[model samples]
Target: MQLHELEVENYRAVRRARLSFGHTTVLIGENDSGKSSLLEALVRVLDGGAAEEPPNFESFQFHRDPVKHEIVGPIRIRIVFREREAGEWAGEVYAPIHDLLLRAGEDCREVAFELRAQPEGEVVWRLKSGKRKTSDPEVLRWLREFTPAIHLRAGMLTGYGTETLPCAPGLCRTGETELDEKIAAIEVAAERLISKTSPNQESDLEAGFKATRELLQLVTLPRDRKAPNLARRVREILGKGIDLNSSQPTLPGSNTSSEKLGILLLIAALLRVARGAMAKEMEPIWIIEDPEAHLHPKSLASISYFLSDIRWQKIITTYSGAMVGSMPLSNVRRLTRRRGVVTEHRVDVTQLSGVELRRIGYHLGAHRGAACFARMWLLVEGESEMWMLPQLARLCGYEFGVEGIECVEFAQSGLAPMIRVAEQLGIGWHVLADGDKAGQTYIDTIRRTVATKDRQGRFTLLNEPDIEHCFYKHGYAKVYQEHARLGGKSTRDMDPRRVIQRAVQTLSKPDLALRVIEAVAADGSPGVPDVLQKMIRTCVKVARSQSK
Candidate 1:
């Protein structure tokens, strides 16, 4: 089942927030923005292995608001699953929960569950339907097993070496008498082997036994590979096998044709978990944290595609623009935290209005992924500005990219629609527009219509005819002339400004921007123009503030 909505309150860093979920939700946020906390909260509420103990009073309680908040007893997390469509699990295993749903007046398809942390070091879990709530321990426990949720940590790959062997007889097999009988024999041998070799780590062996039992209860194991045999093989190979953790692959290495070791291992770990889930006929909800850990750009793309190929539902937390770029903007859920209270913001690009879609279609199509991942965005007037501003800012010693700021083009279609989207997505943004009459009119209209308080202060107008005109006025025409290779060019020409403007218009924005960068590198003479310098500084300040 897919999560339709999630509401979290009194949890770590989250005071109160209601969020919608997609089939594949990508959480993007800066450090300490509660992206990881959101994932942990999901695991805790769903009993998804991450919560070893219920949250305590000081650690997980949300006490940020002083005036309008009073209840501070339990940390609450609730999730509403979407009404089951065709193709969802409708087997006998789920029959008991169907009764609970019907008893609580819930539609047979939709289910809502809430989990709360008690002061007595235990969790209070309940199923809700309309005004009715059911706390039947057996039903709640069964639901937890029925809806399998697995969290794939960044360290899950290297940590697999510690995975203990299944110690219970027929732990991974169910409803197959013949296979179970064979597995029962193998289990005896495997347990004897583990007991001999890892006697000092008896808990690990016992935990493995418990894990096998739990797996058997949750999933219908296929007979292809019995758990006992797999466990025996793992134990036998423990010392004889090559330790995968000894020599991990790093980027810029000898093997350039394939993905790095870390990414490969990550993929393997995720696949192992997926295989186990699939064997049980369950569509698992996999929570992946920082899938880009130790991955190069190419590897990130490959791994992202590999993830999409899986049948399981995924909720990923990421800080990498490359990974975000590989997915649709609609899947992104931007998280933000202020004074220890977390909030979630999402805007589906496909759901935008027709007019807005037309206005920002080019913007979204080209830069949406980068913008979504950025801590702040600098929305500029056209492609030329977008291409030029970041390079220019770098020349002034204020690197936009280093500050997690992305430059995006509004393409002169205006900024109102794009600004609306930015606001909805909770992206901290600033605009750079021309000082020409049309640009001024557009900015003024946006300032009046866009109710966002900081929009006016954030906008940095060139105070000249346009960006190209500003370049000409700053004596950058000589550099442009040098790059464009204009025949019979003269800095003191009759109309060098017009000459440079015409040349910039003729060449591609990216090509011209590269020329400008080369020109700046070749000669540091005029340096950054004062007006552009001021704007870059302002943008850098805003970008840094948002990042912090």
Candidate 2:
């Protein structure tokens, strides 16, 4: 089964939010923006391992608001799953799910697994016919069969400093009662022989056996040193004689990126094994949080591609721009937190077809990749502003990176579609353009097609022809003159735009702008052009205001 949508209410930072899922969804957000909480909620509801202990108040309920004195809620998380139909197991295995069908929609069958926790700490699953307490064995079995989710959280691959060697052949295998019985008998016989021959070693052998009362603990390190789950897991791998590091066969401590990636890959491999055995019967849902942890940018790109190739549905959470840029923007879900409420927004890049995405990919080069991390977007007309805006912002006492504002060069393309993309992504955006005929025409089109009122302001323009004129209008003509010979051209008589264009012919616009900014910086009394100053102040204001 595939998760079609998720509805979470009064769950941690998310007071109320509904998120839809695709084959692959990447959750992008700032720290503590409820991305982890969302994944945790899914795990608690769907992962059978967590069903043993129902969530408590601290885990389920939202914090009470002191000012509002809000009433405690019955924290609820509902996951809608699409039933499998194409595979062979769809009939025998998933047929029972059809009986519990919540609906038969046009595209696919959907069933909701609703988990609700009361204020008194009682949790229940609302099944199709009626509510079932989470303690019910039947409910837990259903969750395992239908919604077996694999959660790969941060640090999952690390921190194994001490681990015991695998047990000898045919010993301490997980879930093998017959093999375990034979091993126990052999151990007893061996212990008796050792005790009779070497009395001094008898006590140590007995102590070792007593310390590990459980069979699964046979291949694990000391109890105090290993995590409980890892302790139980070592025996399973031990039975298979799979030495992770075959060369020198040492228990890894997760020092290298390759080792970390190997751990993630191992998990995916196990899930794939499970998926294949089931005849792709039940869709294996993979939830990976911060897969970029311990991975360099190149590694993250490879992982992103690897994840995209997985057959089942995947949900990944990340804080890295490279991670976001590497994936299809259509799969990106941006999470934002304001005050105490958290929400999710996804840009409708899905509206673009495959060919369209390819076209956009060409446009989204290195400079545009920066937009993945931007809190607000500043769409400029050409390469000059994309290069010059940051420097100009510094000159105006603001920092672009520090403020999380990214300037995108649209190459004089229409702003209407780009504005829609920003709106769908919940990014605060403003357009900067010249007041010429073309810029005016685009701005007028934007005013009609784009939602400017929601943005607080429409396009801000320089009344002069372009930024070069704005520089001349300000007192920067002398600064530009100092950098370029300008053929003794003065802004008073010559066309300042032509002088600026010619200067760029010798030196790139950004290089020339840098030279002027450096000269003005040395001068220490550089005038902030009206247009540049307005843009910087506006960026700062918008960044601050929307960030709140």
Candidate 3:
């Protein structure tokens, strides 16, 4: 079964929010933006509280109004699950709840699980099928058995014992009746031994006491006693015998890094599923938080590949840029909060054609995925602006990193796909274009892509032909003049623009940009160009507005 959708109300930072899911969903957001809360909500309702004790409704778990600072009541989390394929729900485990599966569409079956906190500080779990609803705990048990949730928290597998592998009984059990018979015999013998060792011979004790006192008569009181639970003892014995050294070559011992240990745990879980320990009718949903923790970029890419290959439904939360870039753009869900209310922002890949989708994915995977985390995107033509814009923004008293602005050089994938992605992800974008023909094309694309009302603030055209020319025309003419003389090029009677143009053609664009920024930093006389400063201010204003 796959998680179809989730709705949360008055739970933690999420006042009210609804989220849809696919087979694989990557939750990306800043800290405390409800990512962990969402995952916790899923674990609470679907995992059947396996990983944790039953949640006591803490006051902090309730949503507090940002303005009034008063906690709310009845924290609710609802989840919907549907079959991954048609006619796959034919197992005996699904028989009891067959009637409870609601018809979603053609060959589609769905069921909803709702968990609500009551005024008396108690939690209520209910299963729903269309208009029919029941609080029967048996149905919840059936749901968990049919499709269990595997929640792997961060660092859960880092410090594991290697002497005895902690694994499912199915992993170590052999299909033989002899082991069962021997365990049963041992249980019976142990119970008899306990009975034999008890003080049952009262006559012999009285004879021994006869010498001490002749007149005193001793009596032993008859008392009822319970037998020891041999079955629980057998389970405890079996738990210590199961180990992974024989199966997993590199066991996740104390020496294993947290990153590799997580991957190993996932693989072990999958092995259990493969070995028929888990139900075969539906794959378990894996709720993993920070799978990218302590992983290198290359390792993140490898893990992403491994995760994509698994057919099970996975909900992962991450803060790593490489992790975001490695996954498909459609799988990413960006979360944001304002005034103590969380909202989700995602790209609607359904509206994009296959080619457009591919283009966006290519850009994201090409190390531009960090743009998904940015509040604003400064779309530039090439690397020169990409390298120089942030420095210039700082000169104008705007910190790009602090303000969550990313300079995306969209020369490879063109402008349309990047703009579409930014717009869909709720990231504000502004295009800085040259005055040349290629730049005019960018300007025209922005006009056609962005709404007419938003075009002026989102698009800027430099007065000169390009960045090099613009820098010369604005305030850095002397820097270029000195560079031209050092390069054996006479600039005594040359046009100032032509001099800079020759310098750009000969020197690398990025190198020249660095030189110009360094010169401006040393001089500290002429500030950033007025047009560029205005553009930066406009980007900040538009980005913050869009975020709100």
- Return the top candidate by lDDT: 3
Q: What TM-score against the true fold does each predicted structure earn?
A: 0.70, 0.74, 0.76
TM-score-best of 1 and 2: 2
In terms of lDDT, the poorest run of 10 residues in model 1 is: 233-242
Q: Which candidate is the best by TM-score?
A: 3
Superior candidate under lDDT, 1 versus 3: 3
Estimate, for each residue in 1-548, the C-alpha lDDT of model 1 and write its tens digit. 77777787767666666777777888888787876666767765555332233324444354344565554556778888764564243556666556544432234356788877754556776787566677776665555555556667764443332253122112234345654454343344334433356354335334333333333332223333545433322222121222223332112221332333333334334434333323243445777777776555665664565566445467888877667766666777888887656778877665577667655644554546667767677887777777778888877877777787888777644567777678778877777778888778768867786677755457877778777667767766765666455576564664655666656666766777677666655655566678778877877787677655
Worst 10 residues of 2 by lDDT: 159-168
What is candidate 2's lDDT per residue for 1-548, written digit by digit as tens? 66878888877767777788988898877785777777878776765444344555564356455477574477888877664453322466655444454334445555566777876767776544223222454655665655667665663222111021121222232244533453354344333432356354435334323332333334343432323333323322222233422332332323344433433333322322232122124455777677766555654654555455556678888777666767777788887877557777886666655655564555553336557657888888876677778887887788988898989766533476677667777777888888789788777867687565654565687788777767766667765555557666555577676667777777887787776666556655556666677778887788777677
lDDT of 3 at 164: 27
Model 1 residue 66 lDDT?
A: 53
Q: Candidate 3 has which clashing residue pairs, if any?
A: 165-243
What tens digits encode model 3's per-residue C-alpha lDDT throughout 1-548? 67899999888888888788998899887786777777877766665334222345777788877878787668988889877776555556567667676544468677788888964688877778788777776677666655666665653222222122234322222233433343333223222322344153233222222211110100001120111222222211122222312322221221223333233333332322223234335456767677666544543554565566545678888888878888889899998876657778899888788887887788877768788899899999888899899999898888998888999988877798888888878788889999999999998888887778877777899877888888787778876776664466577678877787666766767778888998778755577788888999988787677556
* Per-candidate total of colliding backbone pairs: 0, 1, 1
